[model samples]
Target: MTKYVSCRHHSQSARSEHQGAVMEALEGGRENAIYRKGELVSRPASHWTMTVHQLLQHLHSHGFAACPKAVSIEGGKELLTFVEGETYNYPLEGPIGSLMALKSAAKLLRRFHDASESFLKLNTQDVHHWMLPSRSPKEVICHGDFMPYNVALEGDVVVGVFDFDTAHPAPRIWDIAFSVYGWAPFKTDEDDKMGTLEEQIRRAKIFCDAYGCTRLEREELVEVMTLRLTALVDHMRSMAANGDAQFQANMEDCHHTAYLQDIEYINKHHQAITLGVLGEIKF
Candidate 1:
């Protein structure tokens, strides 16, 4: 049996250059470790710890108030204030609330992306780039995992965002694709608005319009969505093979399985969905 250490029992030790093991005690089965030094959470030599710290520092500097404040604990574990909000999983009873939530999320992403552009150019010491995609000239910071489950909503408004383990620098389009792929859900109708593809298309338009994306960019939605979906499938497979139970369960589910299997469907109907989203915009 795995030994469990209480959060209080863990002692703060000098920051080491070793990858710390995950503590299975945290809720949501978070892979965390205790660390000393820095008032914010720091995993001495862990890639995720470095990435999360970078993201938090960037957001805090830019006055992005939606992320958790990292706190350093006695042990190697870093404590992030728990965000309080419900996951925007099931569709809202009314379309207005859902629209509001998507709009808010887009605006937040826009702000984060814009701020990250400047940060990327700055040289910081002891920074280890982890999971960062090849940096393109047009690349900004990408929230590698910009799914609905990572976004917290309060009464139809996006309150906070969590999970920056995959944060990296990539093209602005990558960020847009990641968000839309999950929010619009290219292949599966699981997130279809009120149980219909038509409604899903309508909501997709609302999401794109709020983000102020150009028509050409919207047209490439299908292509970008496919790339994002394919990347996600591979990511899930990797996580499962590595013994991530949550990802394994998601991969085994029929809905998620269809989401992975039906990539061809989205590729085939990309134009139609693009037109539907474009038509909804009054410009």
Candidate 2:
């Protein structure tokens, strides 16, 4: 990570050393550009940035400190405190694939949802905006993209989460279903898959149990997962058609095709998955 330092505060050699470490820590590929200076993360500001910042502040006031603190916007960039810890993406391996990681993520997600419920209760204004569309029965604000890549981990324990760009008002199950897809790794893509279908189903059960899901939520999980992915595909195509460069590139690369395949995979095994997560049938 390259560290950016003020010329007034340090010698040339010290600044270079800081820049290298900081930049290394911040490096990763995603749809949006991200930069870091000192302990602040900088990303392009959007019309919804202030609304998201309000939600973050609400979470913090309610004692959920595992997320970023929204700082000020400057020069068309939104700044947030850089959360410390290692982040992993697809192809989960080592600590990322451990049982501890799965359980911890589920627990943390539950905490986040509980805290967010109050936000929904308190904020009655219609001035808020989110990148993702709100869903039916908006019980709590959903961390719309609660996947492995979006969380920060210390060893096998997930300590923090980031990327509120996709945050939206949705049901708790809506978020959990997509999260299970990522962590249980219900994917056919060779680059992202971690286990066989049976293994994935088993992991999903572990996640549900850790999160203390109701039987109703468990029964609805498989169906919700498929619907979520379908919605994702439609959103990608719609955005690409509307000239969003990131989604345009993704469409060109046939990223939507991969999700379509996963959707089919889930549909094909929907019955087995429903039974497995419900503990009525073993995987």
Candidate 3:
């Protein structure tokens, strides 16, 4: 038998040191999620939570205010300051679909990578965390799951990023690749609501320009796109194999196959993508 706990089921008593804040359920966290009293968001703590909290604290100290601030652990859930804005999910369209938005997303990621350099050695791999530690040579803590859906918007401006469960040590290119893949969204023409292949390529370059990637980093862009998503496919397989219920369902729905398809597509057009984003890949 399984026990279920509602977000509202636990709170401080009237006479206790802490007072209850009403928890309103948020729409999109993969884990159980609720926002307390309009100021704090709460989610079940995983082995990675403590480490993620530490990283968030470090980022806050550095002047990047785009991510959540860790608050406290209460009722077995991790409490965090709620970032106010909108998250554009898959099939990204609207202001975020524009070239300006793409540039904003890229610059934001650059800011994250710049601020993240200090935490490279701090993330000593914990034995119980589910995600893998990155092994890149020019590593910093990459926001491993950066996507349009996870980005927060303030009107037409890209203001913040959320969902840090997958943050880990990796090269700046690791996050930059996904920033392009998710925003310009490097997908088949049918799935790309943003624009034509030529337009997508054009916009991808704008993103790279805004990110200020060095010649060598631009040289490695397409390859890192392949590496990043292929690792996602492998991670999905491992999760399904390890009996993760949601991953099992996603595998059944051919989610890994879809990722593999995109990986193949990215590899197939590797040269084009390279040229499209960087004009010419420098060795």
Candidate 4:
């Protein structure tokens, strides 16, 4: 029989000495361990169980304040202070708010990537090696799922990023691609519930401009975004077929349809989107 632990029932007294805040692990699903305080922090078991504490320790050593400070817990669960904020889901009703959120996401990515660069010199192990077979080389730590849902917003502004399960060492472009695919509004007209293709492209440009990405980076960004989007759709399909409830709900929500639509949109307007992002760069 499988012994189940209630993350929610876990006491606050088990928290590590490094953390001065109250924290608790939420119930259900080992994919990520959730905590509540001011905001919810979702730390993936795959990454958090292996290296998140060390990663957080390293970040603190480096003087970074944006990431969650890891704390020890009973039953080997990790604890982190919840970052209070709103989540960006559905559509942004206004144009200005949409643009601002995208720009904010880009800035956040810049900070994450800059911080990740420091890890390159460290002797970190590749977590992916223990997973399925993949040709991608493990490099700097990549926030695998840097999408709107994983980010927390306050007053239409991105304030904190919560989920870090997909966090692993991979090419930095992979992280950028992940963000662009989602925040760039890389969805089809059918998928877009509140805006047009033109509006999405405009927002994408704003994000790219805010990041100060180079022309080469823009081109690579487009390519990687396309590849990652395709791979993600395939991965979700496989998971849904395997009776994964979350993946099932995601698919039932017409996610695959939206993904296909986005692919169609990309094929039809790759040149335009590429030029739009490149044009946004000042240098």
Worst 10 residues of 2 by lDDT: 1-10
Q: Give the TM-score of candidate 3.
A: 0.85
Which one wins by lDDT: 1 or 4? Answer: 4
Give each model's whole-structure lDDT.
Answer: 0.60, 0.81, 0.71, 0.61
Ordered from best to worst lDDT, the candidate numbers read: 2, 3, 4, 1
Better of 1 and 3 by TM-score: 3
Candidate 4 clash figure, as a count: 2
TM value for model 2:
0.90
The C-alpha TM-scores of every prediction are 0.72, 0.90, 0.85, 0.74
RMSD of 3: 6.4
The most accurate candidate by lDDT is 2
Which clashing pairs does model 3 show?
none
lDDT of 2 by residue, 75-125 (tens): 888888877777776688888789999999999999999999999888866
Quick one: RMSD of model 2? Answer: 5.9
Is 2 or 4 the stronger prediction by lDDT? 2
- Cα RMSD of all models vs. native, in order, equals 8.1, 5.9, 6.4, 7.0
Put the candidates in TM-score order, highest first. Answer: 2, 3, 4, 1
